[model samples]
Target: MDARFLGITELTEVPSVAVVIDVMRAYTVAAWAFGRGAEKIVLAESLDEVRALKAVHPDWVALKDGPPAEGFDAVNSPGLLRSADLGGRTVVQKTTAGTVGALAVKDASLVLCAGFVVAEATARVLRRRECDAVTFVVTGEDGRAEEDLACAQYIARRAAGEEVDAADHLRRAMESRAASELTEGVREGAHPDDVALCVELDRFPFAMVAAPDDSLMVLRPYAVPR
Candidate 1:
Protein backbone atom coordinates (compact mmCIF):
# COMPACT_ATOMS: atom_id res chain seq x y z
CA MET A 1 0.00 0.00 0.00
CA ASP A 2 1.84 3.06 -1.22
CA ALA A 3 0.81 6.49 0.10
CA ARG A 4 1.24 10.02 -1.23
CA PHE A 5 0.50 13.46 0.13
CA LEU A 6 -1.11 16.35 -1.72
CA GLY A 7 -2.09 19.89 -0.85
CA ILE A 8 -5.59 21.10 -1.69
CA THR A 9 -4.47 22.39 -5.09
CA GLU A 10 -3.60 18.88 -6.26
CA LEU A 11 -7.02 17.42 -5.58
CA THR A 12 -7.65 16.81 -9.27
CA GLU A 13 -4.76 14.40 -9.54
CA VAL A 14 -5.73 12.23 -6.57
CA PRO A 15 -5.93 8.50 -7.08
CA SER A 16 -8.69 6.03 -6.25
CA VAL A 17 -8.36 6.35 -2.49
CA ALA A 18 -7.84 9.63 -0.62
CA VAL A 19 -8.13 11.14 2.82
CA VAL A 20 -8.71 14.84 3.25
CA ILE A 21 -7.14 16.01 6.50
CA ASP A 22 -7.92 19.12 8.53
CA VAL A 23 -6.32 18.92 11.93
CA MET A 24 -6.93 22.48 13.13
CA ARG A 25 -10.46 21.86 14.36
CA ALA A 26 -12.30 20.90 11.18
CA TYR A 27 -11.95 17.12 10.86
CA THR A 28 -10.88 17.07 14.51
CA VAL A 29 -14.23 18.57 15.42
CA ALA A 30 -15.83 16.06 13.06
CA ALA A 31 -14.22 13.14 14.84
CA TRP A 32 -15.44 14.47 18.17
CA ALA A 33 -18.95 15.03 16.86
CA PHE A 34 -19.15 11.47 15.56
CA GLY A 35 -17.84 10.16 18.85
CA ARG A 36 -20.50 12.23 20.57
CA GLY A 37 -23.11 10.23 18.60
CA ALA A 38 -23.95 12.32 15.57
CA GLU A 39 -25.50 9.83 13.13
CA LYS A 40 -24.05 11.55 10.06
CA ILE A 41 -22.33 14.71 8.93
CA VAL A 42 -22.76 16.50 5.61
CA LEU A 43 -19.50 18.14 4.62
CA ALA A 44 -21.00 21.10 2.83
CA GLU A 45 -18.94 23.23 0.50
CA SER A 46 -20.45 26.54 1.53
CA LEU A 47 -22.38 28.19 4.37
CA ASP A 48 -25.22 28.88 1.96
CA GLU A 49 -25.33 25.17 1.10
CA VAL A 50 -25.51 24.31 4.78
CA ARG A 51 -28.44 26.69 5.22
CA ALA A 52 -30.27 25.17 2.28
CA LEU A 53 -29.80 21.67 3.65
CA LYS A 54 -30.98 22.74 7.08
CA ALA A 55 -34.07 24.28 5.56
CA VAL A 56 -34.86 21.06 3.72
CA HIS A 57 -34.10 18.90 6.72
CA PRO A 58 -34.86 21.03 9.78
CA ASP A 59 -34.03 18.12 12.03
CA TRP A 60 -30.42 18.20 10.86
CA VAL A 61 -28.02 20.39 12.87
CA ALA A 62 -25.61 22.81 11.21
CA LEU A 63 -22.16 23.83 12.44
CA LYS A 64 -19.55 26.27 11.13
CA ASP A 65 -16.48 28.19 12.23
CA GLY A 66 -16.38 31.41 14.30
CA PRO A 67 -19.29 33.23 15.95
CA PRO A 68 -22.84 31.93 15.49
CA ALA A 69 -24.30 32.88 12.13
CA GLU A 70 -27.82 32.82 10.78
CA GLY A 71 -29.18 29.28 10.28
CA PHE A 72 -26.33 27.53 12.08
CA ASP A 73 -26.93 25.21 14.98
CA ALA A 74 -23.57 25.90 16.59
CA VAL A 75 -19.96 26.87 16.01
CA ASN A 76 -17.47 24.17 15.06
CA SER A 77 -15.91 23.37 18.44
CA PRO A 78 -15.09 20.04 20.11
CA GLY A 79 -16.10 21.17 23.58
CA LEU A 80 -19.54 22.20 22.38
CA LEU A 81 -20.11 18.77 20.89
CA ARG A 82 -19.37 17.20 24.27
CA SER A 83 -22.84 17.85 25.62
CA ALA A 84 -24.64 17.90 22.31
CA ASP A 85 -27.29 15.20 22.13
CA LEU A 86 -26.94 14.61 18.41
CA GLY A 87 -27.80 10.93 18.46
CA GLY A 88 -29.72 9.78 15.39
CA ARG A 89 -29.42 13.27 13.93
CA THR A 90 -27.54 14.63 10.94
CA VAL A 91 -24.98 17.44 11.10
CA VAL A 92 -24.07 19.86 8.31
CA GLN A 93 -20.53 21.23 8.56
CA LYS A 94 -18.85 23.94 6.48
CA THR A 95 -15.36 25.26 7.01
CA THR A 96 -12.95 27.29 4.90
CA ALA A 97 -10.37 24.60 4.20
CA GLY A 98 -11.53 21.13 5.19
CA THR A 99 -14.97 20.98 3.65
CA VAL A 100 -13.86 22.92 0.62
CA GLY A 101 -11.01 20.50 -0.03
CA ALA A 102 -13.39 17.56 0.38
CA LEU A 103 -15.89 18.98 -2.08
CA ALA A 104 -13.13 19.62 -4.57
CA VAL A 105 -12.09 15.99 -4.84
CA LYS A 106 -13.70 14.89 -8.11
CA ASP A 107 -11.84 11.69 -8.96
CA ALA A 108 -11.33 9.60 -5.87
CA SER A 109 -13.32 6.39 -5.69
CA LEU A 110 -13.18 6.62 -1.89
CA VAL A 111 -12.92 9.85 0.09
CA LEU A 112 -12.26 10.16 3.81
CA CYS A 113 -11.54 13.01 6.22
CA ALA A 114 -9.08 12.91 9.05
CA GLY A 115 -7.19 14.52 11.95
CA PHE A 116 -4.90 13.05 14.62
CA VAL A 117 -7.99 12.06 16.53
CA VAL A 118 -8.94 9.59 13.81
CA ALA A 119 -5.70 9.08 11.94
CA GLU A 120 -4.88 5.58 13.11
CA ALA A 121 -8.36 4.26 12.51
CA THR A 122 -8.35 5.88 9.08
CA ALA A 123 -5.11 4.10 8.24
CA ARG A 124 -6.49 0.78 9.37
CA VAL A 125 -9.44 1.11 7.03
CA LEU A 126 -7.22 2.23 4.18
CA ARG A 127 -4.93 -0.76 4.63
CA ARG A 128 -7.88 -3.04 4.05
CA ARG A 129 -8.91 -1.27 0.84
CA GLU A 130 -5.72 -2.36 -0.97
CA CYS A 131 -5.48 0.68 -3.15
CA ASP A 132 -2.41 1.29 -5.32
CA ALA A 133 -1.67 4.72 -3.91
CA VAL A 134 -3.51 6.44 -1.12
CA THR A 135 -3.39 10.21 -1.30
CA PHE A 136 -3.54 12.40 1.79
CA VAL A 137 -5.06 15.74 0.99
CA VAL A 138 -3.76 18.47 3.25
CA THR A 139 -6.79 20.70 3.39
CA GLY A 140 -4.74 23.64 4.53
CA GLU A 141 -3.06 24.05 1.17
CA ASP A 142 -1.27 27.16 2.45
CA GLY A 143 2.41 26.79 3.29
CA ARG A 144 1.95 27.49 7.01
CA ALA A 145 -0.58 24.78 7.87
CA GLU A 146 2.03 22.67 9.60
CA GLU A 147 -0.49 20.62 11.54
CA ASP A 148 -2.35 19.51 8.44
CA LEU A 149 0.80 18.45 6.64
CA ALA A 150 2.06 16.60 9.71
CA CYS A 151 -1.21 14.74 10.20
CA ALA A 152 -1.35 13.83 6.52
CA GLN A 153 2.19 12.51 6.56
CA TYR A 154 1.55 10.62 9.76
CA ILE A 155 -1.49 8.91 8.29
CA ALA A 156 0.35 8.14 5.06
CA ARG A 157 3.19 6.53 6.96
CA ARG A 158 0.79 4.47 9.01
CA ALA A 159 -1.15 3.41 5.95
CA ALA A 160 2.09 2.23 4.37
CA GLY A 161 2.62 -0.11 7.37
CA GLU A 162 5.26 1.96 9.14
CA GLU A 163 5.63 2.31 12.89
CA VAL A 164 5.02 5.85 14.17
CA ASP A 165 5.36 7.67 17.45
CA ALA A 166 1.96 9.14 18.20
CA ALA A 167 3.33 11.44 20.85
CA ASP A 168 5.72 13.08 18.39
CA HIS A 169 2.90 13.74 15.94
CA LEU A 170 0.83 15.25 18.74
CA ARG A 171 3.73 17.48 19.71
CA ARG A 172 4.08 18.82 16.18
CA ALA A 173 0.34 19.51 15.98
CA MET A 174 0.38 21.34 19.32
CA GLU A 175 3.24 23.55 18.23
CA SER A 176 1.55 24.97 15.14
CA ARG A 177 0.60 28.63 14.83
CA ALA A 178 -3.06 27.73 14.59
CA ALA A 179 -2.70 25.89 17.87
CA SER A 180 -1.38 29.06 19.42
CA GLU A 181 -4.31 31.06 18.13
CA LEU A 182 -6.80 28.50 19.40
CA THR A 183 -5.22 28.22 22.83
CA GLU A 184 -4.90 32.00 23.18
CA GLY A 185 -8.62 32.42 22.45
CA VAL A 186 -7.69 34.90 19.74
CA ARG A 187 -9.50 32.79 17.14
CA GLU A 188 -13.16 33.63 17.26
CA GLY A 189 -15.50 31.20 19.03
CA ALA A 190 -12.61 28.91 19.90
CA HIS A 191 -12.48 27.79 23.51
CA PRO A 192 -9.21 27.18 25.30
CA ASP A 193 -10.05 23.47 25.52
CA ASP A 194 -10.67 23.23 21.79
CA VAL A 195 -6.94 23.04 21.05
CA ALA A 196 -6.57 20.36 23.68
CA LEU A 197 -9.38 18.44 22.04
CA CYS A 198 -7.86 18.78 18.58
CA VAL A 199 -4.51 17.28 19.63
CA GLU A 200 -5.95 14.23 21.34
CA LEU A 201 -4.29 11.63 19.13
CA ASP A 202 -6.53 8.78 17.99
CA ARG A 203 -9.31 9.98 20.29
CA PHE A 204 -11.96 8.45 18.05
CA PRO A 205 -11.91 4.73 17.33
CA PHE A 206 -13.46 4.82 13.84
CA ALA A 207 -12.46 6.32 10.52
CA MET A 208 -14.58 8.97 8.84
CA VAL A 209 -15.43 8.31 5.17
CA ALA A 210 -17.76 9.95 2.71
CA ALA A 211 -20.36 8.77 0.17
CA PRO A 212 -22.54 10.66 -2.25
CA ASP A 213 -25.99 11.42 -0.88
CA ASP A 214 -27.92 13.58 -3.30
CA SER A 215 -25.78 16.71 -3.76
CA LEU A 216 -24.12 16.37 -0.34
CA MET A 217 -21.26 14.12 0.66
CA VAL A 218 -22.36 12.21 3.74
CA LEU A 219 -19.49 11.60 6.16
CA ARG A 220 -19.68 8.97 8.86
CA PRO A 221 -17.55 6.50 10.77
CA TYR A 222 -16.26 3.41 8.94
CA ALA A 223 -15.46 0.38 11.08
CA VAL A 224 -13.47 -2.65 10.04
CA PRO A 225 -15.57 -5.05 8.04
CA ARG A 226 -16.88 -7.93 10.13
Candidate 2:
Protein backbone atom coordinates (compact mmCIF):
# COMPACT_ATOMS: atom_id res chain seq x y z
CA MET A 1 0.00 0.00 0.00
CA ASP A 2 1.17 3.52 -0.75
CA ALA A 3 1.49 5.54 2.47
CA ARG A 4 0.42 9.17 2.75
CA PHE A 5 1.22 11.37 5.72
CA LEU A 6 -1.07 14.32 6.34
CA GLY A 7 -2.07 16.63 9.16
CA ILE A 8 -5.62 17.01 10.42
CA THR A 9 -6.01 20.07 8.17
CA GLU A 10 -5.61 17.81 5.11
CA LEU A 11 -8.20 15.28 6.24
CA THR A 12 -10.52 16.59 3.52
CA GLU A 13 -8.82 14.20 1.11
CA VAL A 14 -8.57 10.69 2.49
CA PRO A 15 -8.20 7.35 0.69
CA SER A 16 -8.43 3.63 1.31
CA VAL A 17 -7.55 3.47 5.01
CA ALA A 18 -6.96 6.40 7.39
CA VAL A 19 -5.28 6.04 10.77
CA VAL A 20 -6.06 8.85 13.18
CA ILE A 21 -3.37 9.29 15.80
CA ASP A 22 -3.41 10.88 19.28
CA VAL A 23 -0.51 9.64 21.34
CA MET A 24 -0.80 12.02 24.29
CA ARG A 25 -3.89 10.15 25.45
CA ALA A 26 -6.98 9.70 23.32
CA TYR A 27 -5.92 6.72 21.22
CA THR A 28 -3.88 5.50 24.17
CA VAL A 29 -7.12 5.34 26.10
CA ALA A 30 -8.66 3.45 23.18
CA ALA A 31 -5.79 0.94 23.37
CA TRP A 32 -6.22 0.41 27.08
CA ALA A 33 -9.98 0.15 26.76
CA PHE A 34 -9.48 -2.69 24.30
CA GLY A 35 -6.81 -4.24 26.50
CA ARG A 36 -9.42 -4.16 29.26
CA GLY A 37 -11.71 -6.16 26.98
CA ALA A 38 -14.16 -3.38 26.12
CA GLU A 39 -16.80 -4.72 23.72
CA LYS A 40 -16.92 -1.49 21.71
CA ILE A 41 -16.47 2.28 21.93
CA VAL A 42 -18.77 4.93 20.48
CA LEU A 43 -17.17 8.23 19.58
CA ALA A 44 -19.06 11.35 20.61
CA GLU A 45 -18.74 14.69 18.89
CA SER A 46 -19.06 16.88 21.96
CA LEU A 47 -19.07 16.81 25.73
CA ASP A 48 -22.79 17.46 25.61
CA GLU A 49 -23.22 14.44 23.37
CA VAL A 50 -21.03 12.41 25.68
CA ARG A 51 -23.34 13.29 28.57
CA ALA A 52 -26.48 12.75 26.54
CA LEU A 53 -25.42 9.27 25.44
CA LYS A 54 -24.71 8.31 29.03
CA ALA A 55 -27.97 9.82 30.27
CA VAL A 56 -29.96 7.84 27.68
CA HIS A 57 -27.91 4.66 27.96
CA PRO A 58 -26.71 4.64 31.53
CA ASP A 59 -24.88 1.40 30.92
CA TRP A 60 -22.47 3.00 28.51
CA VAL A 61 -19.11 3.94 29.98
CA ALA A 62 -18.40 7.57 29.15
CA LEU A 63 -14.91 9.08 29.04
CA LYS A 64 -13.95 12.71 28.54
CA ASP A 65 -11.39 15.22 29.76
CA GLY A 66 -10.23 18.86 29.61
CA PRO A 67 -13.30 19.89 31.61
CA PRO A 68 -13.67 16.74 33.74
CA ALA A 69 -17.42 16.92 34.07
CA GLU A 70 -19.34 15.44 36.98
CA GLY A 71 -20.99 12.50 35.17
CA PHE A 72 -18.26 10.97 33.00
CA ASP A 73 -16.65 7.75 34.13
CA ALA A 74 -13.13 9.17 34.03
CA VAL A 75 -10.89 11.64 32.28
CA ASN A 76 -9.17 10.76 29.00
CA SER A 77 -6.16 9.23 30.66
CA PRO A 78 -4.46 6.04 29.61
CA GLY A 79 -3.18 5.39 33.11
CA LEU A 80 -6.70 5.34 34.49
CA LEU A 81 -8.07 3.30 31.58
CA ARG A 82 -5.31 0.72 31.91
CA SER A 83 -7.00 -0.71 34.97
CA ALA A 84 -10.61 0.11 34.13
CA ASP A 85 -13.15 -2.73 34.11
CA LEU A 86 -14.53 -2.04 30.67
CA GLY A 87 -15.18 -5.64 29.69
CA GLY A 88 -18.46 -6.20 27.84
CA ARG A 89 -19.30 -2.50 28.06
CA THR A 90 -19.71 0.18 25.42
CA VAL A 91 -17.35 3.16 25.81
CA VAL A 92 -18.49 6.60 24.74
CA GLN A 93 -15.38 8.63 24.02
CA LYS A 94 -15.01 12.36 23.46
CA THR A 95 -11.65 13.94 23.09
CA THR A 96 -9.99 17.10 21.85
CA ALA A 97 -7.81 15.51 19.22
CA GLY A 98 -8.27 11.81 18.51
CA THR A 99 -12.04 11.69 18.21
CA VAL A 100 -12.10 14.90 16.18
CA GLY A 101 -9.53 13.49 13.79
CA ALA A 102 -11.41 10.21 13.32
CA LEU A 103 -14.72 11.97 12.84
CA ALA A 104 -13.23 14.35 10.26
CA VAL A 105 -12.16 11.56 7.95
CA LYS A 106 -14.28 11.19 4.80
CA ASP A 107 -14.41 8.64 1.98
CA ALA A 108 -12.12 6.18 3.66
CA SER A 109 -13.21 2.57 3.64
CA LEU A 110 -11.49 1.89 6.96
CA VAL A 111 -10.64 4.21 9.84
CA LEU A 112 -8.27 3.22 12.63
CA CYS A 113 -7.46 5.39 15.62
CA ALA A 114 -3.95 4.93 16.94
CA GLY A 115 -1.26 5.89 19.49
CA PHE A 116 2.28 4.83 20.28
CA VAL A 117 0.99 2.03 22.51
CA VAL A 118 -0.75 0.48 19.48
CA ALA A 119 1.29 1.99 16.66
CA GLU A 120 3.06 -1.10 15.36
CA ALA A 121 -0.05 -3.23 15.63
CA THR A 122 -1.94 -0.56 13.70
CA ALA A 123 0.73 -0.67 11.03
CA ARG A 124 0.37 -4.43 10.78
CA VAL A 125 -3.38 -4.03 10.36
CA LEU A 126 -2.77 -1.48 7.62
CA ARG A 127 -0.33 -3.78 5.85
CA ARG A 128 -2.96 -6.52 5.69
CA ARG A 129 -5.55 -4.27 4.07
CA GLU A 130 -6.13 -4.67 0.32
CA CYS A 131 -5.90 -1.00 -0.53
CA ASP A 132 -3.85 1.18 -2.83
CA ALA A 133 -3.29 3.98 -0.34
CA VAL A 134 -3.06 4.40 3.43
CA THR A 135 -3.14 7.82 5.06
CA PHE A 136 -1.87 8.66 8.51
CA VAL A 137 -3.83 11.55 9.98
CA VAL A 138 -1.61 13.36 12.45
CA THR A 139 -4.15 14.72 14.87
CA GLY A 140 -1.76 16.85 16.89
CA GLU A 141 -2.19 20.39 15.64
CA ASP A 142 -1.57 22.09 18.96
CA GLY A 143 2.00 23.16 19.54
CA ARG A 144 2.30 20.73 22.44
CA ALA A 145 1.23 17.60 20.59
CA GLU A 146 4.29 16.75 18.52
CA GLU A 147 3.99 13.25 19.90
CA ASP A 148 0.89 12.66 17.79
CA LEU A 149 2.82 13.62 14.68
CA ALA A 150 5.72 11.38 15.67
CA CYS A 151 3.49 8.37 16.22
CA ALA A 152 1.66 8.98 12.94
CA GLN A 153 4.91 9.03 10.98
CA TYR A 154 6.10 5.92 12.76
CA ILE A 155 2.93 3.99 11.92
CA ALA A 156 3.10 5.16 8.30
CA ARG A 157 6.73 4.15 7.96
CA ARG A 158 6.01 0.72 9.32
CA ALA A 159 3.02 0.32 7.04
CA ALA A 160 5.17 1.26 4.05
CA GLY A 161 7.46 -1.78 4.53
CA GLU A 162 10.27 -0.02 6.37
CA GLU A 163 12.16 -1.72 9.18
CA VAL A 164 11.94 0.74 12.09
CA ASP A 165 12.03 0.70 15.83
CA ALA A 166 9.71 2.96 17.83
CA ALA A 167 12.34 4.10 20.36
CA ASP A 168 13.29 7.23 18.44
CA HIS A 169 9.70 8.29 18.02
CA LEU A 170 8.95 7.56 21.66
CA ARG A 171 11.79 9.81 22.73
CA ARG A 172 10.50 12.60 20.56
CA ALA A 173 7.05 12.24 22.15
CA MET A 174 8.48 12.35 25.67
CA GLU A 175 10.13 15.65 24.91
CA SER A 176 6.96 17.28 23.62
CA ARG A 177 5.12 19.85 25.72
CA ALA A 178 2.08 17.59 25.83
CA ALA A 179 4.10 15.15 27.90
CA SER A 180 5.17 18.03 30.13
CA GLU A 181 1.57 19.05 30.67
CA LEU A 182 0.67 15.56 31.75
CA THR A 183 3.59 15.36 34.14
CA GLU A 184 3.06 18.85 35.47
CA GLY A 185 -0.67 18.53 35.97
CA VAL A 186 -1.30 21.31 33.47
CA ARG A 187 -3.76 19.14 31.60
CA GLU A 188 -6.65 18.68 33.98
CA GLY A 189 -7.44 15.17 35.16
CA ALA A 190 -4.35 13.78 33.51
CA HIS A 191 -3.04 10.69 35.23
CA PRO A 192 0.33 10.92 36.90
CA ASP A 193 1.69 8.14 34.76
CA ASP A 194 -0.09 9.27 31.61
CA VAL A 195 3.07 10.20 29.76
CA ALA A 196 4.76 6.93 30.61
CA LEU A 197 1.68 5.00 29.65
CA CYS A 198 1.35 6.69 26.26
CA VAL A 199 5.01 6.12 25.42
CA GLU A 200 4.94 2.37 25.96
CA LEU A 201 5.22 1.63 22.26
CA ASP A 202 3.54 -1.50 20.90
CA ARG A 203 1.93 -2.28 24.24
CA PHE A 204 -1.17 -3.77 22.62
CA PRO A 205 -1.58 -6.53 20.05
CA PHE A 206 -4.76 -5.01 18.59
CA ALA A 207 -5.76 -1.94 16.62
CA MET A 208 -8.73 0.32 17.32
CA VAL A 209 -10.84 0.44 14.16
CA ALA A 210 -13.62 3.04 13.92
CA ALA A 211 -16.62 2.65 11.63
CA PRO A 212 -20.03 4.22 11.24
CA ASP A 213 -22.81 2.28 12.95
CA ASP A 214 -26.22 3.64 13.84
CA SER A 215 -25.05 7.25 13.82
CA LEU A 216 -22.14 6.50 16.13
CA MET A 217 -18.57 6.06 15.03
CA VAL A 218 -18.13 2.66 16.61
CA LEU A 219 -14.61 1.59 17.49
CA ARG A 220 -13.61 -2.00 18.15
CA PRO A 221 -10.37 -3.71 18.94
CA TYR A 222 -9.26 -5.75 15.95
CA ALA A 223 -6.66 -8.35 16.84
CA VAL A 224 -3.38 -8.09 14.94
CA PRO A 225 -0.19 -10.07 15.36
CA ARG A 226 2.98 -8.12 16.14
TM-scores of all predicted structures: 0.94, 0.93
Error of 1 at 143 (Å): 5.6
The alpha-carbon deviation from the true structure for residue 158 of candidate 2, after best TM-score superposition, in angstroms, is 1.3
lDDT computed for candidate 2: 0.83
Report how far off residue 115 is in candidate 1 (Å).
0.6
Residue range 1-226, candidate 1, lDDT tens digits: 6766777776556568888889988898888888878999998878888889899999999999998787888888887777788888899999988888787774579998999898888888877876668777777745248898888888888887899887777788889888988888877867768878888888878899887887678898887552
Question: What are the per-residue Cα lDDT tens digits for candidate 2 across 38-106?
Answer: 899898899899889999999999899775678988788887778888879999999887888888884
Specify the poorest-scoring 10-residue window by lDDT in model 2: 136-145
Top-lDDT candidate index: 2
What lDDT would each prediction earn against the true structure?
A: 0.82, 0.83
